[model samples]
Target chain A: MVKSRRTKAGDIGIAAICLLLMIICLLPMLNVLARSLSSSQAIIRNEVLLWPKGWNLEAYKFVLTDSKYTWSLAWTAILTVICTFVSMVMTTLCAYPLIYRDLKGRRLFNTLILFTMYFNAGTIPHYLLYKDLGLLNHPLVLIIPNSLSVFYMIIMRTFFYSIPDSLRESAEIDGAGPIRILFSIYLPLSKPVLATLSLFYAVGRWNGFSDALMYMNNRTYHPIQLLLYNILNAITSIEIQTQEGFASAPGLSDTIQAATVMFATVPILLVYPWLQKYFISGATLGALKD
Target chain B: MKRSSAINRKRIANYLRKYWTLYLMLSIPLAYFVVFRYIPMTYVQIAFKKYSIVKSPWEMPWADNNGFEYFIKAFRNLDFLYALRNTLLLNFLDLVLGFPAPIILALLLNELPFPRFKRLTQSVAYLPHFLSWIIIAGLAKQLFAPTNGMINIALNRLGFESVPFLNDPVHWVFTYVFLGIWRNVGWNTIIYLAALTNINPELYEASAIDGANRWQNIRYITLPGLRPTIITLLILALGQILSSEFDRPFALTNPLVNSVSQVISIFVYRYGIRGLQFSLTTAVGLFQSLICVIFLMAANALAKRFGERGIW
Candidate 1:
């Protein structure tokens, strides 16, 4: 009975700490949601907290109605789809060959691929290479240059290695080629890793801005992230100029800024919860450290 | 023996012919790595060259080698030094404060008796990990703005000064590290929690039967079990002391705080993209990679010495 009471007290203490941390994570974001929904005057007066002071959907309407925001959103969606498709194809092709121990020059390929994780020629040379390839100012600049992540390839390779070789050997004996076996056998069973890597590539391409900032000079081709980056910079610079803060910038209000940020973030965040189980499995498996 | 070796070679050739499709599949990604990843590595020599736009960096010019001029310029620049200092300081703070955070969180969470409540807390905590740095930086500015941020409002309500959490240089580091911890602690804990499950529950039962208190049980069983994982992760963190997250620093920084917020990766980006000082930035990039390689080797050696898994 004494032990049970002590355990109960301990559980309560643990629960309280966890609850506090969760609140710390939730309150700031919830406050952003509240502020985005609140009136401009309420926001300027700092009246909003966890709840909106004067309920309104003006911010959402402005963000949704803005042609630039809508265009950038569409551009990001298109870029993400193409980039994810290309990345998955390249990653699987690279990963599958490495799974075979008898493959010619396997060691050389492994060393070359792994060398990139340790060293790169940095931004300038990367820019030069993309320019040489005529990738600048083109949508291919975003999609092609970063189509294959070596780390994701390594993870997929590991997943493929986990599959039994007997399956491949039996299929090979039945006169099935490597491509046929990959499409019909391996890929169907490797859905978890495929889904995880596809999501990783999609989310990565969606959130990416550095490459766009460097390679893309055309604002029309700018992803939503780069657009949001410019907008945020404009907002902050304006705030710096005016000590009287939290006011609207031209047609961009505090609520609109909040709304756009939420808009830029919510699509991927929505996908996260549904796919979270794979996230943990992917991370832990990929980070197994040999 | 020679005849058997010849047979082995013939068998290997036959195997390759049979699996030719695999090699065909490998060709596209190999071409990508060669053109995109490997080609730039050859261009690192531009750091040592005085090549301009008229003469492409790939051209192996015979004249004006300009040996180490860009390196000398980069080292002599004040902005480079400031960026270096900021990178070191922020990374050290992250190592000290942020490294052990997930471990502590995992420990606290492992103590929870109710599985449902534990899971709810985990889901909420992990939400921040998925939010991009752009969104986080925006949320951060909103939370810490001097005029009417919620933090400042709370300070005012209590009759305290409204600290410029993001604006002030002194407070910015604290805010930055705090947000880093908040963004990552939950996701980081997943590894530690996985490590925790590997601990033998039977040992805990035996210790309890021997009248060990909760603290003693944790100290004896939990800490030791977690030590290898802690060491391995510590080595990995140490390896990344130089290449801090580029997006966070880039998005969060403004001119007011750029002095303290500039980091090496951002330095590379600013110079390479905006300034177009290609040679100097590549020199700095080389320097950063060199130091990181050294640090990685040293950390791996240290981990191996301590009987933990080294990254290699």
Candidate 2:
């Protein structure tokens, strides 16, 4: 029996609430998109809402043509790729070995790595360490220092633990060494986790700004997000050098700001579908059990 | 004895022969942890010393007040204390206002009559979580700016005064918390949704047979199912009482909101990075880290004393 049949009023209320939430999240983005497509004059006059008025592609053109914007995008992309690769390798190296029960010092290794997740030396010491190691203003500072995340490593390890030990044991019986077993068996089988983690690392590296902000003063080393931050904040210190790079390189920079925001964001938005597919399960699995 | 020693040596050799590649693979990461993670811990000594860029932290003279000078100074400084309070306040606001949004969203989602619409809503909801703070904050500048922003422009058209949704101190707090909730609430629902699935449907069936209403079923069954998760997450959140992401506020905050936005992380960035107050900044950083640890342990202990399975 349908003892608790929902009323029409309650259903409408729920639907309305859900729609409101969706709108709240979507409106800002749509507003930005509309503003970017609209004329700068329309934006200044507040004529544009969620739809464009006197639409033009000038903001996009300006963003694309600016060498400063182009270079920051290029560096961010490069950083994303390199950090993703290095992080995956390092995460794998830290994770894969821990799956074996017989691996010596596995407990100690696990403790040392996992402890840093909860607590660390915090910002200044890490900064001083970077300084001591000559990493200030260095590109490798981003790539190398944070190459491995213990949390992702644990997820990979958990996935590895789920695979049947008999498969590995059979390989060992056939004389497949540890490295060989990993290459032939684990690597090929664990594609989903690997992909999810790669997206995490890539997005992380792409959006990284505080590191570049703190460590990098060299304009050449700044990522897209850092450049976006500077532009949004309108740091007057670099206005002369970067005026052309900001908001269509001209007057009424709001439209150009929206366009620049779009330019900085669309890269991640492109890869987001792939991320959404794997991240839900990967995150739940990590969160619920462990 | 000689024969026994030879046998032990042979066993060690055999073990190495079998596991040499594993050891080789482990060495690089082990070295990485030691250098990148652990070495920084040793540098916390800078907080205790009169450190300068001219000399290594190791060679710095002991700070006046017998290595407690910087810590005392940080504690004494009103600016430092203000930032510390602001850090906790902001995080508390996020914890109070931002944490429950996901749970409510998940519950409403469960109540939805249609799966397709629910799925679409969820996908859209998850979209903002993926965008960086820079992107979100950038959008806010356009959408919420006092004079030229679309919202304010609409308010003016409606004959209402424009609101400083972002550029003002008090209004910025609301916007900050709102954006923080908007960004993470949907994504956070994943765990609760997963937990919801694990709630046995048979209980709902039995309750239905007993003529329970939808509200009763949810109040009795669904909520109890979600209790452990909520508590665990809350405890974990409490452990992070002093820590805030430098990005969220830093990205959104303007000069006008400095009174509220001068959090501990931003404070460190300014002093250590811009002002080059190496010793003082390190002391502050160390203080924040230690408090985080203490809060985590205390939260975990409190949870366990109350008979919840805390994240040990």
What's candidate 2's DockQ score? 0.77
- Would you list the clashing residue pairs of candidate 1? none
The Cα RMSD across the true interface for model 1 is: 1.4
For candidate 1, what TM-score does chain B get against the true chain B?
A: 0.93
> Each model's fnat?
0.69, 0.80
Relative to the unseen true structure, what is the C-alpha lDDT of residue B3 in candidate 1, on a scale of 0 to 100? 100
Candidate 1 segments whose C-alpha is farther than 4 A from its true place: A236-252, B1-13, B58-66
Give the worst 10-residue stretch by lDDT in candidate 1 chain B.
Answer: B57-66
Q: Which candidate is the best by lDDT?
A: 2
Q: Looking at candidate 1, what is the lDDT of residue B131?
A: 77
- The window of 10 residues in a row where model 2 chain A has the poorest summed lDDT is A240-249
**Clash number for every model?**
0, 0
lDDT at B217 for candidate 1?
74
